[model samples]
Target: MTDRNLRHPSPSPDATTSIAAEAEGFLLAQEHRSAAHREAQTLCDALPWLTTAQAEDLTRYYVAHRLRLSRQLFEASLARAEELRREYEARYLRLRRDLLRRHGAWASVLLACAAGVSGALSTLAR
Candidate 1:
C-alpha cells in the first residue's frame, strides 16, 4: 500500500452504520416534503376564486407556520439524538467493564492453577 493509504484513517464500522441510518432518514424527509407540496397545490387549486395577492398572503401565512413547526421538530430531533447517544454510551461502558472483570478473574484462576502445578513438580524433583 502507498504511504498515503497507510496514513489515511478509515471510518469505523459504527460510523458507516450511522451514515446508512442517516441516509434513510433523509429519504423519509424527502417523501414528507413531496407530500406537503402536493397538499399545498391541491389547496391552491381548490381556492380558485382567491385573487393572486390573496393567495400570496395565504402562502406567506402558512410558510411562517411551517417555519415555526420546523424549528420545533428540529429541536425535538436534536434532543432525541442526544438521548440515544447517551443511552448507547452507557450500555457500551457497562459491557466493557463487565468483560474486563470476567477476563481478569479467569486469568487469575489460570495463573493460580499453573503455580500449584509447578510447585508440585518441584517437590517431586527433590
Candidate 2:
C-alpha cells in the first residue's frame, strides 16, 4: 500500500495550530453558506418560472456541483504552491552553500596573512 503521510506534515498539535485550523474552518463554512445563497438567488432570477419545489431541488444540485469545482480548483492551487515552495527552498540551499564556501576561502586567506604579519613583527622586535 502507498504511504499516506503528508510530505510536509502539519506542525505538532500546538495551541496555535488548533486555533488556526478552527479559524480557517469557520471562514470556509461562512464562504460556502454565502456562495450557496448567492447562487440560488442568481438561479431564481434567471428562471422565474420555476416552482418553489423545483427551484429548491435545482439549487441543491447547483450547490453540489459548485462545491466539487471549488474543491478541484483548491487542490490544484495547493499542489502548485507546494511545487513552488520546493523549488525555492532547493535554490536557497544551493545559494547558501555557495556563500559559505566563498566565505570560508576568504577567511583562510585572511588568517594566513595575519599569521605572516605577526611572525614578521615578532622577528623585527627581537
Candidate 3:
C-alpha cells in the first residue's frame, strides 16, 4: 500500500507563517479600510483544500486588483482637478475684464466733466 504521508503532505509551519506574514503586509498597505476588510474576508473564505502557495497567489491577485482600482481613481481625480483649475482661470479672466471696462467708463466721464469746467472758466475770464 502507498504511504498516506507521501500521497498528501501538509504545508510546513514556516510556509504557513510566511504566507500569513505576506497577507498581513498586504492588508496593512491598503488605503481603504473597507476594501482591506473585504480582502481579508476573501482570504478567510478560501477553501481548506488550497495549499499555502495557492492562498498566497490568491492574495497577490487581490492586491493587484486593488492597485489597479486605486490607479484609476487617482487618474479620475487628477482629471477633475485640472478641469476645475481651467474653470477658475476662465472666471477670473472674465471678472478682470469686467472691472477694467467699468473703470475705463468712469474715467471717461470724469475727464469730460473736467474739460467742461476749464472751458467755462476761460470764457468768463475773456
lDDT measured at residue 46 in model 1 versus the true structure, 0 to 100? 92
Question: Which residue pairs collide in model 2, if any?
Answer: none
Which whole-number lDDT from 0 to 100 does residue 113 have in model 3?
Answer: 89
Q: How does each model score on lDDT? A: 0.82, 0.87, 0.80
Sort the predicted structures by TM-score, highest score first: 2, 1, 3
Candidate 1: where are CA atoms >4 Å away?
A: 1-39
Off by over 4 Å in 3: 1-50
Which of the numbered candidates is closest to the native, going by highest TM-score? 2
Q: Please provide, for model 2 over 5-77, each residue's C-alpha lDDT reduced to its tens digit, 9 standing for 90 to 100.
A: 5564556779678999899978996798679769877987799899998988888888888878878988999
Residue 28 deviation, candidate 2, in Å? 1.1
Model 1, residue 58: distance off in Å is 1.1
Candidate 1 clashing pairs? none
**Model 2: lDDT of residue 60:** 83
Q: Against the true structure, what is each candidate's TM-score? A: 0.65, 0.75, 0.58
Q: lDDT score of model 2?
A: 0.87
- State in Å the error of residue 118, model 2: 2.8
Error of 3 at 114 (Å): 2.0
Q: In order, how many clashes per candidate? A: 0, 0, 0
Q: Could you tell me how far off, in angstroms, the CA of residue 50 lies in candidate 3 after the best superposition?
A: 5.0
lDDT of candidate model 3 versus the reference: 0.80
* Stronger candidate by TM-score (1 vs 2): 2
